[model samples]
Target: MSEIERLDLLEKTLGRILVAIGAADAKVAQLFAISTGMLGFEATIIAEIHSFSCFTFLFLALSALPLLFSLFSLFMVLYPRLDGPESVIYFYKIARKDIDCYLKQVGGITNSELMDDYARQSHRNAEIASAKFAWLRKANMSLFFATIPWLIVVLIGYAAV
Candidate 1:
């Protein structure tokens, strides 16, 4: 594919990544809200658990692992956004005079080497972001699956009592 096409694809990919990040952020926010609400109902939960068998408490404790894992995953998802790829201005400032020379070589006088370097840098950032998203997805799944044990305990405990 042409360099332009590749760049276009990269840009599109970046856009999609941003959207995914936003959606993930929203979901995480919801999780936090729900978790916080649960906190408000903590007394009720504890009261319920108080009457249950030791097994119920054990399962309740086990449920925390997934919550922790999901939290770790949330941080992974935020890592890229928190410490984003170097900005063009930052690169320009760091590279100093090299930026001018790079710009001069643009258009018909394209500096293919410099272009490739920029592309490489973008690709690296994209890869990291994509990987983070993968972890975030896994974390989300973990968060979901974590509820199962808690539900099982609650149902069984209720039936037992």
Candidate 2:
């Protein structure tokens, strides 16, 4: 295949990866929302339980600990990290420059340079996606752990009322 064909394929691959990142981020956000709601529900239950017994506190701690950890993990997935120097293909960096400067830089780059940039950007984005998925896994694990205690909290809460 020609270099141009290779470049096109690389560009498409990079775009697909970017879209996957966005989808993963959306999933993490949804999980964060669910965990937050669970925490709020637990807090409300704890609040309503006016008779603060040791068992009440124990169960609340058990349920809330993993929930808080899940939230933290979810937040980590959303957190932005600025690693390495910006590339010509990095839209954020490109947009920061004056229009003339951006045009000049783009006009000056050869097809080979642009392809190199795309390859580098693709690798960087892949690394970012991997990190996000790892965080997502941690968040999922913690959320699952929280549900076990949460069910107990629900039982105790219903009995108290």
Quote each prediction's TM-score: 0.60, 0.90
Model 1 per-residue lDDT at 42: 37
**Model 1 spans > 4 angstroms off:** 1-26, 35-44, 81-110, 153-161
User: Considering summed lDDT, which 10 consecutive residues are worst modelled in model 2?
Assistant: 80-89
lDDT of 1 at 154: 53
The best candidate in terms of lDDT: 2
Task: Report the C-alpha displacement of residue 30, candidate 1, in angstroms.
Answer: 3.0
- Per-prediction backbone clash count: 0, 0
lDDT of 2 by residue, 32-147 (tens): 88899999988777666667778877878888998999999888888985564567888778878899998899889998998898898888898988898898999999999889
Off by over 4 Å in 2: none
Candidate achieving the largest TM-score: 2
Report the lDDT tens digits of candidate 1 across residue range 25-124: 6666666555444333433455565466777767766665676677777677666443434434224334644656646544334445444545655565
- Give the Cα error of residue 38 in candidate 1, in Å: 4.9
Give per-model CA RMSD: 5.2, 1.7
